[model samples]
Target: MSKLGIKDIAARSGVSPATVSRTLRNPELVNKDTRKKVMKAVRESGYTPNRFGSSLRTQQSGNIVVMMPDITNQVNAGIIRAIEVEAQKTGYSVLLGDTQGQEARERHYAQMVSSGQADGILLYTHRLPFDLDNLTANLPPLVNGNESIEVEGLNKVMVDNVQGAKDGVNHLVALGHRRIAAVLGDNNAPSNRERLQGFQQALQQAGIEPDEQYLVQGDYTTESGMKAMEALLKLRKRPTAVFCFNDDMAIGAMSVLREYGYAIPGDISIMGFDDIRYASLMNPPLTTIHQPLEEIGQASMRLLLAQLSGKNSAPQHIQLPLQLVVRQSTGPAPESD
Candidate 1:
């Protein structure tokens, strides 16, 4: 039996060999029906294209770099897992770049694309690394995942933070809480900034004025949540409800609440964003706005793949939907004082 090759796939799929090659290299360039046929033929015949030889001929790298601040975070892990799965479907490898919140480290990773080591970049950050500026003459495609950058002309896949926050806060408002507060993460991050805006908007809509003192900054850690909760406790008139930027922060705040002998929901209703796995396993399960991490990653990969295939269009912002998961953490606001 002859070894299956591109020609065999083309013959089996009823397409030219060039079409089979194109579909294998950049599936997005081939029409859906044709791509499907070629893929089916390849699968049935167990034909694996010579990726190394193909890369050399095309002067391309079958690799994509995914940059993120922290890979240890469950949220980041979930998104990257999905991105890898999606990239693998198209014969591309994903290179994980943990920036560790350092500028130099980020620049080092960005150089991979400019140096022809990776085809493109997927970012979970607000700024394109400075090193990429030198490659303006031939910058590879970039797709932002979850986090948003200030630069224009880059596609993004993220949830609507503003709307998600509003929905969470509105839930508290509906529960008759007037003295509401927020434990927000890094204000520099677009998602956190948008969530803060949403919290304010929800308050305004509920006829409650935004209180500056109630808006505390957190670094999106459990420790930051604890400190934010401490600061709120020091206020002359403490808030009856609080919303956290993420579940970890919420867990931090909850721990402080317990230390000070405050009852969850009974004394203060708490809410959070980014429904991580542990959100439901806390002493009192947390109610949070759920960001579809997997879907966001998949969308980001698809956007980058489209650009890599020369499917040009205006930059797209694919905002995925958010769900408000209600659990044991929140309840009706406590009766006045």
Candidate 2:
């Protein structure tokens, strides 16, 4: 059977081809009654609009692309769900792409924007290629979600990492933990840097000097967390408390500590960031900083939609607030200390 054509729907709907095209590309330009009529006629006639041709004419794919460093992380799941919910409300669909934290994979997705396969791109990758500015010049409007990259004119939605980290550390300090260690995510990532700075600031505020020997770096992975814990345990005077950049790493560190016969919150206190779903389910619930993952996702989608709608609004940099959720993982410093 021959494929359905636009002319068939246009003829049946009593609308011109140009009107049908506008209805598909910019539905807002068409009245509600006309759009409903056109949509019904198209659906009744089994008409599938040629998105590729429409994209070529209007420089829009009618689709949004979302790229994240890792898709399996629980935090990322919340973010994706939020973005999808908001995107659906605007008559847009999202194409999720995972780069697995590789520069080449990130660039591949970025190139999709230039090719008109996506109207805009949402990036949650960290340590993106340094040449992002050069690449951005050739792509569609881009937005950062939960991760900041250095690119002028690009909008961003992030949480207050520094303040959150400081709050976590101050909580530990208040619990009488003086010799605190940290398992950090990628040192180069902006969020990690901010968190580390906040930790240092909090220590200084408590009249404690930053101890480099107690700090270990990880890649925000459970395995890396385990390794970092191993290194931290080798310290001459092990920390009485440990702060992790994220829940995954914190959980990893906890596993290692348990293997080494250290009782959580009894031998050493532990804290984490990004209060992921599993944070509250561990043997000893994790104490963590709650980042508004869903809100960040919604905000990023809203920003992209606003740009697509030709709203001449200022580029936005939304910094959502963070909260500290205390639980079983953190307690007063060990009596032995």
The number of the candidate with the highest lDDT is 1
lDDT of 2 at 91: 78
Residue 65 lDDT (model 2): 86
Predicted structure with the largest TM-score when compared to the true one: 2
lDDT (tens digit, per residue) of candidate 1 on 5-25? 788899999999999999987
Residue 238, candidate 1: C-alpha displacement in angstroms: 0.9
Candidate 2, residues 1-337, lDDT tens digits: the string is: 5877788778889998888877977899999999999999987887887776766776778788899887888888899999999999987889888888788888788777767778888888864433654755643677887878777677889899999999999999999999999998987688999999899999999999888888898978889999999998888899999999999999999999999999999988999999999999997999999988889889999998888887856678989999999999999998774
Give me the displacement of residue 313 in model 2, in angstroms: 3.4
Provide TM-scores for the models. Answer: 0.84, 0.90
Cα RMSD for candidates in order: 5.6, 2.8
User: Candidate 1: where is the Cα deviation over 4 Å?
Assistant: 1-53, 131-138
